[model samples]
Target chain A: MTTPASSTADNHAWLRRQARWSPYELAFWLAVLIPFWVFPTYLTLASQIAITALFAVSVDLVLGYAGIVTLGHAMFFGLGAYAAGLLTKAGWGEPLSGLVLSGLLTALVGLLVSFMIVRVQHLALLMITLGLGLLTAELANSLGWLTGGTDGLQGVDVWPVFNHFEFDLWGYTAYAYALAALFVGVAAARRIVHSSFGLSLRGVRENLNRMPAIGSPWRRHLQIVYTISAGMAGIAGAVLTHTTETVSLDSLSFQRSADVVVMLILGGTGRLYGAILGAAIFMIARDQLSDMNPQYWYFWIGLLLMLVVLFMPKGILGGLSGLLRRLGG
Target chain B: MSEIMLATQSVRKSFGSLEVARDVSIELPRGARHALIGPNGAGKTTLINLITGQLAPDGGRILLEGVDITHAPVAARVRRGLTRTFQINTLFPDLTPLESVVMAICEREGKAAQFWRPLTSHGDAIDEAHEILARLRLADEATRTTRHLPYGKQRLLEIALALATKPKVLLLDEPAAGVPKDESAMLFSVIDALPEDMTILFIEHDMSIVFTFASRIIVLVAGGVLLEADPDTVRSDPRVREVYLGSAHGH
Candidate 1:
């Protein structure tokens, strides 16, 4: 009995230690800020990376943590972009409010869609999400008068952030705004994944059959995480619309959804930092490779993916952590 | 007489032509230790599933503490103080035993929806989970990933998880399945030490463990109960011997 008390305390301490941020995580966030100073000319690309990284993190919340395999995540992202773009176009162009409202709206839709998404599993779930994504893209295309279709939603007028910092051509404000959003999104996600709800999601991912017997309803947990993930993705899309002042039809396309998945796979799934790292690497590689050879960039990208998969199946971050463990031991 | 903790009245289930449960009826009083003994293909696991809401019965009622809960979901049943362990190991392989049990405790406490706070903040749940692990003699293995644990320890972890729910009625479908013979006896000793007020109904193929731990023996044959009586009576009953114990001992 004496041993039980000490052992229980040890378990509690161990869990707290695991939840604490490591030095590497702090260093990663600090490094993210360095681009604003050092890469002044490349701020536009840097902001794009930040927005995409945020999107990747949102995808990881569902696909990695909750074990939801969805191909329609970009539907919510696209919806948020359109929501923010249309709001600014119509006269309500408050940047912060627009972002919040867009995220909440997408969350509402996500909650509704999750009812259907949580009902199925495996291939059926994938098909439903993919079908919904295609349907949204087609609907946007058909409603050209409202959405501007392939010409894109032009004349999106976003006022200066906080009425103080205008979005400059140099992309200083854009990079700062996107970076702030990324930090907030990552911090919130980190909190969620280390919580009981997050642990339950992992349990659902690991063995869904065993959840109910332990008194946890699997569907409810999945639905909550899915809705939250959607909301985060929506916020990322809203950031893009605010920074770019345009909403293209490609924003809601299946390609965007697939690209986020690719980013998550490249960085590793389940871990939040992996998503951000993957996004940064993929976008950087694309920027440099496309500049070098415009028409054949895909060939290089494909080769890089193959190399990563063959050599580091768990993704670069996972591989690095494994190496670090072996070295430390 | 003690109050009935669990009862199934004329429950029926079938997989097309295969009758897994045919008008099956059984009862467990408070604190009763009952062993369900039967030959292979006797539908013991299926009966456990029917009670736990994994598979809906074709007809009849399932009552817990005199409340009919035949149509309740598995989670609802667990919340109502009824829990069960699987014949095969079903666990979170990547998670440590401590994390898994704490998550189970959080679910039991209705705190699983708390996402804003870190898991360590649930101090009560963590302590409770650790207590459960220690009670099951898994304290040393608590921090190891479940997939890396030995087969016997993994089986024990299953029972530990079930206990975290604080169930009043526990149904164990071969809780010691696939464990070594020596470990199986240790497993039963743990089961024997559970709260006296808790009801238990277990399905076991090993007669020696069954006769030692079970105050009463229930012989199920072909989706129906052939005999239900005290172990002394059950051991002497020719029908029980012919259908179950006879073959079990022969092997």
Candidate 2:
């Protein structure tokens, strides 16, 4: 029999093997600083892309990791947007605190809704989420006084972050802010999905019937992931709201939710860095393609999406990773 | 006499008009190796389900270590050391055998809720999972995705998952139903070698395997216990010869 020392070494080696950072993650972190050097005037666009990527990652947490299909994820995003906007308008305009508050509010909403959402699966879950998103939109439309209705909540000015970096018209500070949120959100989510709780979520996803038999509190795991995902989505929303200095009904629209889901699929679901790549490819493509063909940009976007879904079902990043692995690189 | 670790009192279950378990009563003493046997549709699996809290009995109470647990949830029952395995293999098909077992071990250790720490950091759970896979002779396939494993090995992996929980009363619906004849021996041998402190109640159709491994046999017919006796007595009963074992012995 081999010595225990040899076996422990083998286990350590396996752990180290899993610990290697993917090139995608390294490039993403390094790429966060690129807008500052190359395209200072395009900081607004870069910040929007970062915020959108973080939203997609949040959706990926529940949809990809926890296996909860949702069509109303933007409800949390919108709530966070409105919360930040309202907080600033209400004279408590600390940007970081506003972000935290908005995220917490969205998470609280998620916790409450998870009672109904987690109990159902698949079609029912999708419909309930859609209904909730539409309901929130309708509420915002009707509550014209607080939400500012069709015109959006106007006259909201975000205070400079940390009383230091001023909000510039070029969006340099905003880009940094969104990237920081993404970095923290990604770190926390990566830690979570690699943990035992995350494994149990995969266990629930793979065999929900046997999860309870294995002594897992399946419902609780789902609720925790759902709530955390909601909070992350909220942070993305708050960042966008603070960056743009407005919270609009568009934040609550079905289009926003659907777009994030598309971003997740385009990036791949379970891989953490896929969301960033997906959002980047999507946002950048829409930006560039729309500028070239303002009237028929959807044509090009739709064609690209169809090709992606047809050929790369695991999403663009997952396909690239697989290809790289097969090449023995 | 050993203490009664599990008991069901006149438990009854009905699916619409069809009664699956009719006033079934049972007592499982600690460390006992008992096998439940009957023909098809005998409510053997239903009885296991009721004991494991998968279904609530229509009529009586289920007691675990003398405390009523008829109303407990499946997870609560499992945490109380009463665990079960499905007749059909149920496992995380995408996870490696080692990961699946480690998750089960973590669930048992109440560390499955630890989200911030990487699961690999729980070196104890990983080591324990490795040891269990080795015991089940599945160490070679430990890192292989369960879906890629042979069906017989999947069946053994099912048992390995149950053993990871360290259940006080392990209720196996059918541990060898789909395993090959040769592999079935290896599976039962592992079951036969389990520590005597962990009581086992398994449902099996294979009389040869049951008679060899089970110290006591409970025969069910039409959702009721027809007889409960030592394996020799059960094999020798005239009624068993008539209703179940007749003409099939070929021996």
Candidate 3:
């Protein structure tokens, strides 16, 4: 029999063989890094890509890892945004503290809501989230005294980050910060989905019956994932609010949730980088198209999403990755 | 003397009007390799479910050793050393065989909820999992994804998974079902080699294999035990022949 030393060597060699990066992949990553060094208007676009990518990644935790389809995800995102906004407008406009409070407050809300949602399945889960988001939006509207409602909570001056780095109107600091957060979030997500607990979660998804047989408490497993994914969404929201320095009730809409699902599908579910690519591609297209045809952009985006669902059910990156593997690329 | 490891006292279950399990009492003494033989629609799986606390009994008591577990959930029963495998429902498709076994072992080790520490960092659990996989002769296919494994290997993985739970009372619902004849015998040998103190109850329609391996045979007719005795007596019992052995041969 071959010794352990030889086996370990073989494994390392196999991984090395697999590490050959495609030219397109190299180019894409290089472009992402370019915004970090080059000073240009690409900063705002990069910031949008980072925040949107993080939000998409959080949504994928539920959709891909735990296998729950959500249409009311904006509730957490909006909660985070407004929580930061309200605290800042309340004469406590510290960026560091506002970000922390945003995540904490949204996490508490997510915990309460997730407990009620654990028993719901499929369309009920979607509808309940939708209703929850709508209710939150309505509260924000009625209590404009707190949320600033439809006009949005504006004129909020966030103190410099760390009491030193002032909010850069040029968007450089915001883009770099957002990109770092997204990178860390995606990397952490990758670790969880690759772990044993995550594997058991997939087992729970495949067959609820199988989990108990394997000595897993299925409901508790689902609840844990829900709570963690909710917190991740909250972080994404806090990051978005931090960069924009403005909060809008638009953050809590069914469109936002549906858009994230579209992003996940556009990149591919169950893949980390796919979420990033999907969010970037989606936001870029929507922004460019809306610039040209602001009123009709929604119709075109919807048409394209349906086309993707029909023709490329795996999402763009998912399909491309599979095609590459099949062709020995 | 054989010690009683698991006992059910007139346990009853019904799905509305359908009486799937009725007034069932079972005893699996420690070290007993008990065979539950029945024809189609004989409620063998339901009996297994009741014992493992998957479906709560409508009316009777389920005692594991001296402890009453009638109201206990399936995970609780698993923790109490009662582990079971589904005939067809169990097994995760996308994970590697090693991953599935590692998850089971993690549960039995009682620390599956730990989020920050990666599972592979736990050296002892990995070693224990390796040992369990080795027992089922699946060490060679450890890294292969579950969906890629052949049907027989999947069945082996199922039993291997149950083994990883450190079960004292093992209930297998048709462990040999859907597996080919050669593979069934291989599976039988694996079960035969299990620790002698373990109490194993399994449902089987394969009478030849059942008669060859089982020391005790319990025949279930209509959600109730018709006969519970040694294999020789059960093989010759007129009622067993009439309800079970006869129908099985009709095909």
Candidate 4:
């Protein structure tokens, strides 16, 4: 029914649009399509990437956009994991409701913590956040009865997503679920950073002293963003708990906090897509290198991170963009 | 009857016996085009900071519209319509002038909390931002990030930001400090054209600029008021002449 000439022209236009894709957009599509083209065995790896990216992006919301450096973001993640686990144990194993309930509960804790968090800046803020994360980890460890005492939360059960897709052993459903949540999280963060409130946050980041004269309560703004960011992190934690059907003390560990921060910086901070790119690269590298040499994989990661900091302070996406610019676009 | 737009009563401040303000009191009525003149380090900026609630006074009351705001926070004071600029230009280095003005306008209108909508969707804020940039003759540079602007333009943008808030009491600390004399004229002309009811208190080192913009001038020496009088009287007062104008003429 279509003319040959018109069809050829349409094909040409489509090719042009494809050629014009930003590296981040290209990467996003590739990530979304991993299950179709990648080995079926790597599907769980894809799920891990998606969940870790969600966590990294939430950290970016605070560190990258709001300029609040934190090493305690894992506290929110752990709170969410525990909340989802407890909900499932109580016979309410609905995935969507679990995600929301955990997110809100983590947000409430984040809001309370932010009062103290926003009062400090720079090194003090960093130290306080780190301390808070460690304290939560210790609490989970000591209160084993509630959190399974370092053995991890036992017997967490997740219902099939919407009663349609069973969580297969090959992780097709889990990967899909995590990717969808990541997509929604990225979309929401994009909306926030492009809003008027987001502009004011950057203003506060650039110059805190000038904010008062412009009639902005910068502390209040920082607090609100921190709470929202923590909630986003909570969603990531809930996703991991539901997919694996287990919650562990590692969820609250400082190492988890540090690793995500590293991943965020590796992919670049401030921009949302950096979270996805960084998480994929970090998790995949860890998986492969650890399989190759289980004892020294961290050495390689540390080396890679050093190289990134030294040569590309802006991270992977930022470096790529700069390269593209210098090469005359 | 004209009422006091801003007043400070016997405010005292000291940094470990290095007194910056010693029992300084001022009553600036509405529409008063006043200037605070002093030699360097006489605490002209400190007084502005005190009135704007940046630094708490050790002793005294600051009242805005006869309501005491001595204990108010900086944001609260700005919301009550008191705002100031700095001797050194302070602006969001990453934001464009249009974005900067839009943010100020939004914050003033209590729209800074709306996080769901795109900033460009606020048609009223965007329109008002454009109008303000045009008034300040910064329309051409509206989209340029403020860090890349010339010093004179940055200074103008600082005033533009303060103006966007529709402040009842606008305090500009050395608004023309880094600007060339020729451009400073242009800057003052813009300030000159603002509504007459907006009480303005500016600190300036240029005697010509001060005499032209301010109806009354208050001179300070060594952290204390030397004289507060109409321009002509302050210009001729021997005490002011010995303390400030002497140094001015000597230069």
Candidate 5:
């Protein structure tokens, strides 16, 4: 019989093995970096993909891991966008600091909102989030003097990266900045999900009733995750505002929230890589399909979503992992 | 007498008009192996829920080690050395037993908020979880997903999770509800092996398991305690025989 010490060592090794990066994961990250050198012309599209991927990861933190059903995620994103825009418009134009401040501000709002959000579940939760989203959108719309309303927030200026590289017309700096933020956000999210705290969140998602018995308060866990998720999404939004130098009503639109949900579903929920892959695939498909057939592009997107749901049911990443398992077996 | 670890004084609860628990009072000293046996809807589970803070008692006081905790939340109760297992198996189906137990241990240690470190960094928690699983004869199955485990093992996992909290009082609601007869004996054997200082109140239907494992039995009928005595006394009591054991034996 193995000694207790040896068995524990085995368990430690096994846990580390589970968290270690596989070759496929490494390849995916390498591919994320490849667009900078291999496809310079697509830098603008690539940057958007990076920003959306970060946003999708934020959604997955709540929706996929915590099992919170929300339709108003864009509230934070829009908040971040406007926060960055307003900051720049007011002359605090440093890009990195602007991003950090926007994310922090969004997190504060998320913490406040989570007090109400964590109290409800299922349909009520959905409605509260939806109402919050709409409420914010209308608040921004009505505050024409501040947010510029339908005209969108204009004259927002962003400074250089650490007083070094300048924001260029070719989108070089924007792509690099957004990609760096995505990497950091994704890494932090990955760390959170694989930690003891992350496991508790999964436990909350799987059996919320059981968490209390095990000494983990379900609502507190939900609130913490929601706040963190909101902050990450806010960062993504701030990145967009910085790159594009514009903030429109679309930032907080219901459609933006709905589209992020679709992206998460397409990529898989729960898995960090799935969110990134989903965001990348969805954005690429939108860019390509809309170019090929602008008016009917959504038709193809709908078809793809249906096919993914029917065959995979777990999202593209889930499907791929299942297939790999079968082949190995 | 041993110090009282858990006590409920005149606890009462009702769903609209149907009174499920009626002015019930029960006390458990440290290390007491008490079995709560009653017929269907006799408030056995309700009493457990009331003590564990799952449902508010209509009127009464609950004390844990002499501290008033009548209105504490479920998680707070757990953190204060009170824990329970569901009658129905409630588990994280996608997580492995090791992960579930480690998370439980983390909750107990207040390390659940350690978001920056990797799970493997908690080597001590992992070791403790493995030991707990091993104690329940689940060490081999620790790495397997909880959903795919045999029904008997899943029930054991419930006890394992409770034990992870180092609970001073464990309220188990029909822990062997759906397990096969042969397996439940082993399940109780594991419970029997738990620390002797831990107080355990379990609800079980099987008389043999109850008699074999429990040092004392509390019989309830129509939301009131019929008798609270040692196994031998409870066995000979005709009222218990008539109300519960009689009908229980008939099946």
Candidate 6:
């Protein structure tokens, strides 16, 4: 908190600070939350939105902030799901223990894979991560003993909240829990982005030459952010498994990985709300389109993505922001 | 110790088959304003790269306060109080001058790159950035993006960024290059007013600007130091006259 102003004049000055949030952030969130609670179907959709938002947020932390482009983020997500699934199967089914263990297991895998991925940049990073995601799917397929292979590791029963409250399928406890968790994750990420370290990464992105001139080890900073983002992605994946007690090979698939990136771009690249906005649009479109035709649904999405990539290169929210810029100018 | 804050001794660097900076040396004492003048392919910039730790010397040593920093990485060299401006103006194109300076000062203060606390919360850093801009006569341009500024102003912003590093020594690679002819004095005044604690080594093709500012001049001809002399000797030397001014203006 800021030091309380010594005089009335100083207090007034603080009130006028530019960083103070405007009514837009307040009103926009109010609108989003009302819908989630109003519709019965929105509860399930909202929880999925929260999970996918967290996952996409993790990807953006790396892509937008850290400048590591990848399409294989599902590798971390899948690792997290398997971790939660397998721990429950092993009878460590308590909510707190299962959640903590799942995050830890996913984090461990992330640590091992990060050193290799962080060394490459641009398209090479993209290609390597794609390979890594595909390889993870194949490994999940072969590890039938642990993951139940193609059939999946089923019968995961997430132990009750604090060993007391039970999970319901309808619009109740699960959605709220995910929303609370998402708020914490997003708040922490927001804090991290405004820190001195985040400025250094922006400097790195601007010019690799400038970092050393300004006293920053570019590679080391990149590694640290990548590692953190991977762990966060892993935790998001684990949360999905906890909410829905199933882990399958599809979790590790490249298609899931690509979908998350598309969601990230759909919202906005670097904007904080981009991930949440992206995930919401992606899930709603998928749901609406699937109802129309299960097999042909993806074709419409492909068309939408093409139009957005060409005309709205900055993504949806970004395009809106650009519109504001032109009007202001 | 000759009051030299930075010294490059017989440093040599090259790219592939081209030996760009061959056995070059210079000493920048505290408060010394030195100018480097050379023809188009004279290797002045290659030598500047060696001093700034962007290029490791193929041979010889570089010392900051007599301690060898020949192999120090660029970041380490910067923390040791060295800063440089690029030949081509480089700024965060979209960021206003105030934001750019805030970033530089933050780096010097060891702030993490982007901690999510709002940028306005960095009162001290922001104030220092504003002060630097005002000192450089850039106060009016604080809110304007560097890329949108006039060419001469962009050059000053580059120097402002270097100044933000609070360097003990500054290396400027052609600060006046490509600046609009009419805007030359605006850039010159900014460079002229730099604090004396900052040892300056600037490369310039324009003799008028070089002679206008520098106390001492070092002439590089064809990838090596040809002569180090006071302005009087450098101006009168037949060799410098033949090599540089003669080539450019045909005597």
A63-157: candidate 4 lDDT, tens digit per residue: 98889999999999998999999899999999999999999999999999999999998999999999999999999999988899878999988
- Give lDDT tens digits, candidate 6, residues A1-329: 23333332343344234334557657765665674557867788788888889888888888877777888989998998898887887887776666667667766777777888867878889999999999989988988988899998889978887787677878466776677667767776766666656666666666666667766667777776777777778778877887777888888889989998888777887766788888888999998899999999989878888888999988998898789768877
**i-RMS, every candidate?**
3.4, 3.9, 4.8, 12.3, 3.5, 7.2
Off by over 4 Å in 1: A1-6, B249-251
Residue B50 C-alpha lDDT in model 2 = 90
* lDDT tens digits, residue span B172-240, model 3: 888988988888998999999999999899888888889998999989888888889998899888999
lDDT of 4 at B230: 95
Candidates 1 and 6 compared by lDDT, better number: 1
Total clashing pairs for each candidate: 0, 0, 0, 1, 0, 20
lDDT tens string, model 1, B4-69?
999999999999999989888899999999999899888999999999999999998999999999
Tens digits of per-residue lDDT for model 2, B21-132: 9999999999999999887778999899898988989989999999999999999999999999889989999888877998999999999989988877899998998888
Winner on TM-score (2 vs 6): 2
Off by over 4 Å in 4: A1-27, A326-329, B249-251
The root-mean-square deviation over C-alpha atoms between each candidate and the true structure, in angstroms, is: 2.1, 2.8, 3.3, 6.3, 2.1, 3.9
lDDT of 1 by residue, A1-329 (tens): 11222388789878887789999988988897887789899999999999999999999999999999989899999999999999998999889999999999999999999999999999999999999999999999999999999999999999999999999999999999999999999999999999999999999989989999999978998889888988999999999999999999999999999988888888989999889989999899889999999898878768877887999888889888989988887
Name the DockQ score for candidate 3.
0.43
| Cα error of candidate 2 at position A234, Å | 0.9
Q: Which stretches of candidate 3 lie above 4 Å from their native place?
A: A1-30, A36-39
Against the true two-chain complex, what DockQ does each candidate achieve?
0.63, 0.53, 0.43, 0.32, 0.61, 0.42
User: What share of the reference contacts is kept in model 4?
Assistant: 0.61
Please tell me how candidate 6 rates in CAPRI terms.
acceptable
Chain A superposition TM-score per model: 0.97, 0.95, 0.88, 0.91, 0.96, 0.89
Model 6 regions lying over 4 Å from their true place: A1-19, A35-37, A96-101, A108-112, A162-164, A325-329, B113-121
What's the C-alpha lDDT at position B130 in model 6? 67
CA deviation > 4 Å runs, candidate 2: A1-9, A292-296, A299-301, B246-251
Instruction: Flag the better candidate by TM-score, 3 or 5.
Output: 5
